[model samples]
Target: MNRNALIAAMIMALLGGFLLFAYLKKFEEEASGGAPVKLLVARKHIEPGTVVTDDMLATRVVPAAYVETRAVREAEKARVVGLRLATPVQAQQTLLWTDLAITADDKRDLSSLVQPGMRAVGVRAANDDKSFALMRPGDRVDVIATFPIEGSTQRQSIVLLQNVMVLAVGLDTTAIDTSKQGGSPSSQDLLLNLSLTLPEAQLLSLAAEKGRISVALRNPDDVRITDSLADLNSNLLTDSKTRKTVQDFRKTPTGPVKLPSAAGAQ
Candidate 1:
């Protein structure tokens, strides 16, 4: 045949072969029923412990081969509708069953925030005691317990918990909202939530019930655990010279007044 005719035939043969391959592939996919599956994905950045709502979720159709093993199926929408996210999910990311905290109540509960073997215990404090409302979530603090000394009538203070994380300060856990200056939380409703082991939770509860509890904010990097239980008496003064000088001044009266003798006689 002619050179032009031969090239035209080859092009026509290639086009026919491409069409046949496409038709066969379509038939195979239909026979196997391998269509794209819909996966539930986060429409926005969902933070951990957030309740899953309709507005925050969307669906994406992924090929059967590309579908993730643990991706939440669109058919299971009801199961995850009210559940909480155990970890943060980025926008347009496929939601996984493992990422959610499934509970019968289908609510975002505070217990979910507690560690596996730990408990979340809340302790009430006077507003003036806990940084005057400056404390917020994730702040580390040392829980101080003040109660009457066993034998003496004076009150002594001791650190009950050191380098403990403050889960929630007051009812709000995210931040201290001061938008409405006149609607600040009352001192009576102030609370400090803590994550502690079972034994530690019990000890903290007992201390709160029996004595006064206060929190001393600490530097985040200060993880030093000291066994030193210093008493809150005058003797606790670091400088002995200053303590002695104050003692000598208190003993002598500035004005001329009749002083009682150290002996029984007045």
Candidate 2:
């Protein structure tokens, strides 16, 4: 055979062999389940600003065709910044979705009143008492007030309120460090400005006029609802039943029951 023809035949043979090998490889891949099965990126709990790492991918026990490349790619770009994650991901509780807005004023306000999920009560602080230094905004306390009648020695120290929120201390709306005092802007000496309801405020004012007020710390678990003196007093004085009883008592004859004189009886 001619040299050129032999060379051409050899090239053609090599080409044919290459094509056969490619075909066989393709057939083997088809018969043996194609490429390796991979994980699907779950859509739930995908937080904003969260970096998608290999660990974030969700794998399945059985190889399935439902896993899409697009889903995986999308998950790779997911991030979390502020919002809460609905579900916890593997080894990760989804990142925040948005920025949390927490400011000094917010913290101060929250420290005072009933918080988002908390219940609050009101109590009175004494103007002349020195024990206010012992109380704070978050401190739990039982309020006691004593009222003395005019021109009389009788005095009653009753529990005016309980489980009340200490909103502020000595006009400091925010939290204060009571431990240290006497510095620049000299801190007020533990004068607490408590948050009280309208009725509690009235009671505080009334008690301040007649007697002294004091506070007692309570157990963390001891939350009691005390009677509102204003409401009780108003009801006792104005209620129809109470009014009728008072009226009947007043209408009863004041005439003294006559006992037989000793001489008459003999």
Candidate 3:
């Protein structure tokens, strides 16, 4: 072979080797970077405030580059199982930390929802009050107490607390637990959790212990403070002709004077 042809052949061989080495390096980098990572995704449409369950989640293999920092991994399914969702997540969408209603540490205790310096007091629901069954977290309510008067057999219903924020409806802060009954009699009882001030909590605790406690649902937009001192009495509905006359007796100079009692005598 000619010297020039031999030299060109050697150069072409070296060039080809260099291109092969570059191609191999690029393939190696792609192989190293394109690994699949497992991410937790919602198996079905999960509404906000719905409790996450194992069946509602599925593992999805996605490119590592697409995995977000806040994305929950398949291994974290156990931790997310009982947690609530703060926002709705579509089916097959990746579950993220921000999508959760509460943090992992705060899921067990809903005190985080209570305003700072407020108390979370749970009052027992009256079996007859079906409104408790419809309540949800973040709802507003009026706490009503029904118990007999100190010396009378007549039951009196009073508004013990007003415009109270409902921290939870049932034991599980996320779900409506109609099965959990808990009144004075087990069958008639359900728990209604509320957020109140210290004094309001004390009042509610006493009311719950002394009488049957019931909650009246309020409109979320209706935060109007009710200063009503009126107490409801069943006698108001009874026929006036058959109702017994109540008199307010007071001491007087001549003798004890009597006057007609108010509609509801406190």
Supply the TM-score for candidate 3: 0.46
- Give TM per candidate: 0.46, 0.37, 0.46
Q: How does residue 236 of candidate 2 score in lDDT?
A: 42
Name the runs in model 2 displaced over 4 angstroms: 1-128, 173-178, 181-187, 225-266
lDDT on C-alpha atoms for all candidate structures = 0.71, 0.49, 0.71
Which digits, one per residue and each the tens of the lDDT, describe model 2 over residues 186-249? 2454455555666777777787766777788765445555444321233345479866764564
Local accuracy of candidate 3 as per-residue lDDT tens digits, 131-161 = 5656766677877898988777678889888
Candidate 2 weakest ten by summed lDDT: 93-102
Off by over 4 Å in 1: 1-108, 127-132, 176-183, 187-189, 234-266
RMSD of each: 22.1, 28.2, 22.6
Model 2's lDDT to the true fold?
A: 0.49
Model 1 has an lDDT value of 0.71
Residue 172, model 2, lDDT: 43
Error of 1 at 186 (Å): 2.3
